[model samples]
Target: MFGPDKCRSTDKVHFILQHKNPKTGKFVDHHLKFAPSVPYDKLSHVYTAILKPGNELQILVDGEEKRKANFLSADYFEPAFIPPKTIPDPDDKKAEDWDERDKISDSDAVKPDDWDEDAPMEIEDAEACEAAPGCGEWKRPMKRNPEYKGKWHSPLIDNPNYKGIWKTQEIDNPDYFELDKPDFEPITAIGIEIWTMQDGILFDNILIASDEKMFAASASSDVLSDCQKKVFDVLYKVADIPFLEAYKNQIIGVIEKAEKQPILTIGVLVSIVVVVATAILRLLFGRKKPQVSCNVGETDAPGNSEENEKNDASAPHPRRSRRET
Candidate 1:
């Protein structure tokens, strides 16, 4: 179904924050956000009986999916760490021979043959996947990175800890992390409550690590803040209410909160219009109301009746008389 705001779920989805490399201009790490969304597909199974209705439009975001990143604000700028194009790590073996003549699609490039649920991926196993006839034949798979520029990715990501083919530019953290003295100051991370657990901590699992690290909730059940705690509480009571009663005033509040984007956009637009109208009115009428003397002969102000009358009488109308304004 294509609506005007038809962005692929993967494309539109982004982390609440992404750490950047000050020197190069790249995001070093990213983490997801869990702000509530309009309630859609909510399924609850009670013991053997499943509760909660089954369908509505829903957005699914898979962390594994790939998409280009967009920087949201120009106010904040971070340099990206661009990996060196040439000089990949030198492996001990003859750089894993390449055939030099083939064109394989990206889908075929890194896929392992023995990727079945139970298949072994051990390099020493006899059943381990043999390189595709065209694998590395057309394009030799690149070597691991010699310097830890950031996270070690498969063929696409360079390895920083590699001791071969490259030298370390710096030892500890990269330089320029502080573009200025003020930029270097530490920022207290908000929403850290997302990382806590009932048992002091749910678990510490590093899902993505670069200069910065991204973590999953100690447990999916881990409530990191008052909000998440409320969500979890709602999950518990969702089934207790009758199907129709499930949507109480509390439900309306939650739904409205989720849909605040549209409401906020409207509010801002209205405020801008009001401000513009007020500015226009000020421009037309100055600020203090225009002064007018009602006396027919009054000379002080235009639009003053006294001024008008005075002018009229002097001009032979005899109706001009000065009166206190």
Candidate 2:
């Protein structure tokens, strides 16, 4: 069973490993929390958890181990390390009048004269004077009552009738079997089952091996690259075969229809041939001729040049004359 989904701190990714208890026919969960959190908004690097045979587990993030745990004793696991059948006096009843306080009130204390017994603790000081309007009388402040014995209680003492905490009696677990050597139980399948809040999660390179070395070799870059190539080939070629075949059939149908009407087919074929021939001719000799500049190596017309020179010589430039003067 999965642990709590939401309602927990968002800072951690919780992983729960559950095993069936043969004796109780109930599932026991082992939970692990890892942090420096999961990046859900973007592509997060792969995280790996390695659990070895000897109750040793390591959490790795991006190929580096973050935390390691060694379970030398069953105390690290719950239900396996059961509490004793009896425990120190959890049920020991305390006497109703038992008192644990070390201090007592002093009976000789007296109230001072300034203690106005009738005055209220809070009087209106709104007038901004030493005395407020309609609140001249100050109430006496409360103090520890001298006559109070502070709820008399008897000191704590050992209980003569203290019966200890009751625990589950130990018996042989029907499901537990002894193993000859330290080895992991055989895993028949490996799968991923997750509850995600958003979509578009991409899972790749699921690897399983006997140990870290095998996993490292199998999940190498070269291996993953080959796997990706295979996947791409299958998707583009194998998966698209039906659609491609249908496309080819459609073209064939069009050709067959055209063949039924020879005149129309011939006309279309002639048009296509013309278009193809024109395209080929254009490709072979498409270079545009270098344009001749209208004024290239050419002098101005005699009439315009003479007229311009006459105009320039005849025109009186007042600014030029002033500079010359």
Candidate 3:
């Protein structure tokens, strides 16, 4: 499945290999049937195929191997389809008179008087009935049929003749033969055959290796990171003009407001600073407001004049009354 309609194979990937069987003189298809479906999108993707010693082949997506199999075993045998271990014995057959169903409907059952087989399931509200005052109250109550027997079926039981999973004996494929080890051949290059509607698709980081460690080291290199950074830098520069303009307008608005009320702006800033400082002081040193203790008869505590001066300094200053000119 490639596209939304799946009518085209442009996005579809099918890994195929055509091998001429020397014994049979016919070309054999030793291909992977369940290749991972490629997604058609703007995001980049990586598909990799690794052929290692011992005829092991691995398919990777985005540097992670998703499928693996032994090509030797797969090509020489039917890897996709497996013979059933147990099959129903053809010699054992159900008799013509045998009834598999255990239950049947009771022929003597009769319909109840209140069944109301012809009654309507829902009726109009009595208030909405124009001709009759209580006309719409006549509705049939939906209920289960009294004489209905739920779907009849035979109860399951262990079979004496199960003869658990019968498997066909493995036989040598007369036409199958092994290719020379060197004939497997080293992969000198990788190729992509794409019939796409769009062009300019850049495929990068093509790696071919029999050793897993070598492939891992190459795939994990910083080349991709550097390329991604370069691409995103250009993209951000192209897309940032509107955002920068909007931010500039916001800063200008703030400056204009500050110009209109310089004193108010200063007061608000000072108040914010004071609040933040007070919170920090409380958090860091556990400072708290001092509770003033004054006796009922005493106007002021002894040696408290300096404390009163400090309180006066901390409180907001009252504006002095102006003298007449």
Candidate 4:
């Protein structure tokens, strides 16, 4: 079964190969999911799934192979379709004397006489006041005690009785069986099951046949190609008509109103022309005036001799006077 599915935010092509488990006598699904090369909703696309006699599988979109895998490969399928050859023996049990613990505490470890259990974990600094001057009535800070010994425990050692992990013996599976071509199945009827929040989900030209060449020929037929093209063309044309017609009507109405009011139309056109002309003239000929700067205590005009003498007396000593001195 191959179908379209939306997974979270992305659209995917979902494929399921169904087979009955030989051991359990129940049907199981081998799933393969991937994003389509082209959106199926946006355009018409041909999706194909092929299973060969050698158990080789291929998935194609628009005649281009997107995925290929062997049916028996564990990398492609989930819940692995094939049963294992060896099974854990149900009758086999672990030995009664099995020791699972890998490590044990030493029983002969003794506490040394120097090890003090009563010692404090931290001690206050005795020279704190001497180190910091004028730190009135100082509260000494605590530091970790170098000689402190914490609660003691014997070190761990490897257990001599350890037998590693216990396991049940293996036996040949009675239900296990192998098939040369696991892809073959008897077909009585075809069915499609779909669940969607959307409408207008279309399924067309569904083919179930063993002949690969026939399927390819049907997909590539000129009639089918033309039909798909026509459907797309008609849909787009119908969707565009309303908006296009509204624009056409507005243009026609403007022309009709202009014909009825020629003077008003001419006045509006003249105003628009004047505005455009003014902008262009400014852009071409507009220029800024050059700026002139004067010193803090000086004027641009030449002064009279009397004014010059007064200005010279009030000014600070010049660089020429300093050089001469």
Clashing pairs in 3: 85-165, 85-166, 86-165, 86-166
Scored by lDDT, model 4 comes in at 0.65
lDDT of each: 0.33, 0.47, 0.49, 0.65
User: Against the hidden reference, what TM-scores do the models get?
Assistant: 0.16, 0.40, 0.38, 0.55
lDDT digits (tens) for residues 1-325 of candidate 4: 7866664675767778788877777788877634354453433456788887667888877677888877776677774567668899999999899998999998888888898888899999765665676657767878889989898788889999999899888999887778555745787787878787765455657788888877676556412245444643443353345434433444344333333333234443444345445555666776655333324676534658687666666774455455448
Misplaced by over 4 Å in model 1 are 1-13, 16-40, 43-80, 83-325
Over 4 Å off, model 4: 7-12, 20-28, 31-46, 61-66, 79-81, 117-121, 125-139, 211-325
Q: Give the candidate number with the greatest TM-score.
A: 4
Identify the superior model by lDDT, candidate 1 or candidate 2.
Answer: 2
| Pairs of residues at least 3 apart in sequence or in different chains that clash in candidate 4 | none
Model 3's lDDT to the true fold?
0.49
Q: After superposition, how far is residue 118 of candidate 4 from its true place, in Å?
A: 5.7
lDDT of 2 by residue, 30-130 (tens): 55533335543332244566777766666665466665654333444443422233444544555655554444444445555455455544544344454
lDDT of 3 by residue, 281-303 (tens): 66688766644443345354579
Error of 2 at 179 (Å): 13
Ranking by TM-score: 4, 2, 3, 1
Cα RMSD for candidates in order: 27.6, 20.6, 22.9, 24.8
Q: How far does residue 131 in candidate 3 sit from its true spot (Å)?
A: 19
